[model samples]
Target: MNTTQLERIHSGKGFIAALDQSGGSTPKALQQYGIQEDRYSNADQMFEMVHEMRTRIIKSPAFDSEYILGAILFENTMDRTIDGQFTADYLWDKKGIVPFLKVDQGLAELDNGVQLMKPIPGLDELLKRAVERHIFGTKMRSVIKEANPAGIRQVVEQQFELGKQIAAMGLVPIIEPEVDIYSADKAASEKLLKDELIRQLASLDQDVKIMLKLSIPTETNFYSDLMQDPHVIRVVALSGGYSQAEANEKLAQHQGLIASFSRALSQGLTFQQSEDEFNTMLAKSIHDIYEASIQ
Candidate 1:
């Protein structure tokens, strides 16, 4: 990759906004506005509503790309047309925001109490589709709700293995291994995850580079060394059920780590708000997250 391209993928200047709620998470998001799943009747109907939400964001006065480096999209969002332009094209051409796709199928239970994404059966084909649509990268998630050495090791291996495949296809991968904030052993979980992550990355070829989307650490600056690693292109954080205020506080403590939050990024934003009110809240959230990101 060119030096400029590397910077575009790795720079610590901006944050990513995650809008890629799969089918499993979308209905709950709609329910927050009192729209029930039964009203949709079909998956396409549901997707249309999500597309409208995306349209609102793109058309908002505060939807500048300055604070937002990129937006992650569900597969449908990747293909859907917005104002006669494909969603990915619209984001890049109009907002200058890079587009990424969520490639993982939702999580599946592991015997050890962790969750891993279901197998993505046609990932290479999906990568070809992403390339055709001009998507810049992909994001997949695995969750560690408790501390288990065996489970953490599995998550690290799968994420890096998949990440290498993504990079080989000429797109960056954001390997998100999120630790649930509610866990009693959050600190120990982070340590185990980080140790496994370092081991996995060290095993890969030296030229390989990938991004990490982690939960905010219980220990301040716990991820500093990972952020500085040669193999880590960038380190981004998930809200992982944290409130916007708490997420910002934790994120601000770690340098070179930025936010790629979903719920926190959209907290207080809803269809019920007036356009002006919606814009104001969204802008403030972006500003606050941005400040934490670059601090």
Candidate 2:
């Protein structure tokens, strides 16, 4: 592990920019950027367009480490290049932001009121490649839709189990077990999920430390204890389905939790805007999120 990068992530006062929109969510992300589905003929073309979008954002002046501690990349993007350098290299070398990769294949079918990550057949190989490419860490996601103890337990267990594997490869794992914001038992689900996370975290070895990316809890400071846990490097909040305004408002209520937003981070950015207009908008977004993160 690079101690410098690890220290930046541990004590940085800014939020993480989630640029890792995978195959399953790429179309919607591109559409929001003003590229229509009709613009691409196939998956290859779709990825090309999305990569272009990501490159433009990264190249923008507003996207810097001063207000953005790190950025997550999709596997495809990690393998690609920007200005003759690998994407991850460009991010850290030129932009001064730590780079992380999204490692999960995608979600599995809903079971026991939760949706776990599908098997990652080539994960070890991928992690090796990530280490070679200067990636500092990785993120994987799962979802909880109810307050079922059995279901939430499975979710946390899977996350920690995979997290341990990731850490063994000398990379921090951002374990995201999101509680669906619209679930009827949203608060109950968060409570149950928090307990399960605490239990899983307690069982880890002293040398292991992981990050948590969770939905904005229904109750403010609901995960305060987790934020202060020794095994947790950091606790970040996902916007889930909330708008940027709503997500930031909720994020500011928690003193220690920072933002790791995807859609919310890219909100209001479009392909049609002039360079000046685009940079200005992105700067504002970064500023707002950074301020909320430090609160």
Candidate 3:
């Protein structure tokens, strides 16, 4: 939800997954690509996998410090529920790296658990504090199946309240209207979607900066004009985890960093033994992309 931190990642669009699995000294990243494949294995024997991953990197004999160039918090999965602010704290403490969080994919269950853990703890304070910055959320469907204006009103009202909660806290809530593969009525579809976005933003009544954040739009033209505006920066989120092909496509076109939730571990790596192995592999792919561009 921290917007400025997200902006910082454009320097290197990196891959991210659960931190619990990705800490190790082994260059599994290089090895996974057959550069050093013999050196890799799953860390199935470890008790504290995430901690182990962290230990490996922080104590690496190669790197002088834990100053990784790029880091992604796999906002998918329950890692955050056990520690919502943990990743945030890690990023805050770890300078020289752009730390980004990918939410909306696997946040539902984790969010629910947090609510139950501290329900009604500080609604007003959270809302007010959130207004000063961009608090991004993944895709949220704020539509009514019923065609009645009345039904739309009810749904819109909910979005407005939530938007207000975000805006009041000094944060801009990024209400993304998704147009994934199966969506029909491209133009009309997006219009409807953006309309809902605005309805909620309007209800916030100028308390926060309202930018229309979205995944890859149906066509770039859908947001071609808006992309130039300083207040509007797009997220080039490519799902299906990560692939060299998809990474290349994003690297060629996007002025912003590419996002991945599931794709990091889902593709490319031949051998996988543990979560740390998986995470290191994902980070390596992203880092390689960064390196390729730098040279």
Report the lDDT tens digits of candidate 2 across residue range 208-281: 98899999998989999997889888899999989999999999999899999999999999999999999999
**Candidate of highest lDDT:** 2
Please list all clashing residue pairs in model 2, or write none if there are none: none
Kindly report which residue stretches of model 3 are placed more than 4 angstroms away from their true locations once superposed. Answer: 1-85, 95-160, 186-188, 195-204, 210-213, 228-244, 247-280, 287-295
| lDDT, residue 144, model 1 | 94
TM-score rank order: 2, 1, 3
Please estimate how well model 2 matches the true structure, expressed as its whole-model Cα lDDT.
0.94
Give a tens-digit lDDT track for model 3, residues 159-197.
445545554544444443333333344444455545555
All candidates' TM-scores?
0.95, 0.98, 0.49
Q: Evaluate model 1: give its lDDT.
A: 0.85
Best by TM-score: 2
Off by over 4 Å in 1: 1-5
